[model samples]
Target: MNSHYDVVIIGGGMVGASLAMALKNTALKVAVIEPYPIPDARGEGYQPSYDARSTALSWGSRLVYQQLGLWEKLSEHVTPIKKIHVSDRGRFGATRLAAKDYHVEALGYVVPNEWIGMTLISALKTEPNVDFICPARVEGLKRSEQSTCITLSKQNPETGEYDLEPQSVTANLVVIADGGRSETCQKLGIEIQTESYGQHALVTNVTTSKHHGYEAFERFTENGPMAMLPLGESDGASVGCTDARCALVWTLPEDEIDAVMAMPDAEFMALLQTRFGYRLGKIEQVGTRHHYPLKLSQAAEQVRAGIVVVGNAAHALHPVAGQGYNLALRGVVALAELVSEAAGKGENIGALPVLQRYINGRYADQDKTILFSDKITRLFGDTSAGVGLLRDMGLVGLDILPGAKRLFARQAMGLGGTEAKISS
Candidate 1:
């Protein structure tokens, strides 16, 4: 337990696990510290019935998974997003991006968040190079000129109990992938710039009588955008006949969230149908709904003396474009690649300049994504007539202009106009 490792990743979620797995065959030693209970194979399908969280993986992200040999591992649970439909309801015609046009089989894939976590951890359990420590939380972190040392306790960090007896582990590099509220980032005094959107996103799954045909919809309404991402074909044998299900992300004003949630099933369905305008056609059944407050948070900088922030710790963008995980995926890929290169060169893998390269490689794209998502929030959420007109015209222009549409499609898929690049 006293031995040092090449790298320590503080968060065993998707981003952290992916980074660790990517480094598996390399010479670098890896350790993942997570407070939550790791998903065991027996508990794989028994996810919390209350969790309706979902993620839309971009094409670029899919490539990263493929490279890590994970795409095929969890392919059964994923549904392809073949087409993206964007529109301003009650106004201009919608803009569409087709997978065929991009010459890719699909624009992206939709996977439930719980499934994602389970699949990643299941894979990590088999990775020989990784040391998985769960139910173990980090209590304190300090960096020396040569390496970083962190204190770990068996209980969760918040509980302040040292049941396992405090232990110290140092690593050449430390990556903080802790989610939105990252304790490691806080302990390091990393500053975050955040914009709390006065909105709450209600997420769930809905089945329609008609087939979705693998189309993903982003309908901009007065309240906010409502997204319906198609899931895989349902087993036609089911009683609900809900074979064609789609994940829902309905954003509403914070003040209106409770009102919407309190509405009877029938009333709420009616409201959803009206907003989406019969596109999906008759919300036959809706799954359990989960609401989350929306906010845009960006780390002022991602690099520290011995640590580099990754995932939600580094940036948490608005889910309006469903780029939170996609952005995180890009960050994970970049950091892993940079670290691997440093290891290959026999350099001080966690040297300031080495870590700085990782930070510099990540900043531009992360910044653009944060700004793009934040701008979309402000632009559509404003609801002012002038803003409406502008957005409408922009939609129209995007539809008619081929170049603009292409650029928009690339950007939407987390693959454009940024230094931090994720290859697909």
Candidate 2:
């Protein structure tokens, strides 16, 4: 194994893997350190970030993937979201945003996390300038004047235990793209601002009696906001059933999650139908349900000497707007461009000035994205009469006004603000 490289990225999830891909054709040598083993065909292995969760990819995200030459491979597996219907449950205010209104083919695409992981892992394996350090953990990270020193322990293939002895890898730059709960950032004394939403998101796939027509629904109920993203048809049966399914993201109060999860299938479907209404028709079937607590967290410092943080390591926003991964990918694109420029100039990629440039370029977008997600979570989650009335008026205005709809669509599509080539 090489002892030195131009870049060492900690974490091989979507963001980190995408970074490696973005820099693959560049002159810099890159290594990705991931603790989890590569998932097998069944996806039953130990990758943390790759699960059954569905991700809503904005149009900007599609452009990013298209630039990376990954869109063709991924397009077949994704279901297009042609329209988004936003409404307040039992309220008169409802707004509809259509792809035609924005002069686009689709608003976004819905894809499973597992498929994305597999595709990225396969792509990274073929990159000549990239190295995969799977089943390996970073024990320690030290930043020096010249480079960042990383101590890693490789796991034993037979027993899945890390070796007693550790090896060191030194790189001109260390990029951290690990998820929100990053031990690496904590070890480096990077403080993060965090706020708990006192809510949990229940996720699952469900079959509807009627076709979804490639439309996404965001219905705000008294309990919380619930979203039904059209999945079209099921590609492969999960939990021993196959039907027209849509991915459901139901946000509920912390105390009510257990009771909801414990309900019988019929009872649960009934509850969902009641809350979600009959827009998509009856909830005929639901697969296994999973729940995770929601929070807003962002690293206080995104860049330091010899190191830069991206993805969830830098900011993990509420999923209300599905902006977390999109924002992370934009940051990855900006950082990659800056690093490539630095490498071309024969400058130290990890130098404070170089890293600061990346940070400066991304600060405004990050701030806006974080606040957008946070405000949506707070505003829609509140069921108070005053707030509801205000939100209803906002929704009505958004529907009636073309300019307002266009602005909201641009933001949702991640095309607002200073446009980057990667997001073009």
Best by TM-score: 2
Candidate 1 lDDT score at position 85 = 92
List clashing residue pairs in candidate 2: none
Report the error of model 2 at residue 216, Å: 0.3
Tens digit per residue, CA lDDT, model 1, 107-136: 888887776777787887887778977667
C-alpha TM-scores of all predictions: 0.93, 0.96
Ten consecutive residues with minimal summed lDDT in candidate 1?
A: 43-52
RMSD, model 2, all Cα superposed? 1.9
Model 2 lDDT, full chain set:
0.88
Taking the tens digit of each residue's C-alpha lDDT, what string does model 2 give over 88-179? 99888899999987789899899888888887888887888998887899999988889989999999999988999999999999998888
Query: Runs in model 1 with CA error above 4 Å?
Result: 44-51, 156-164, 233-242, 417-424
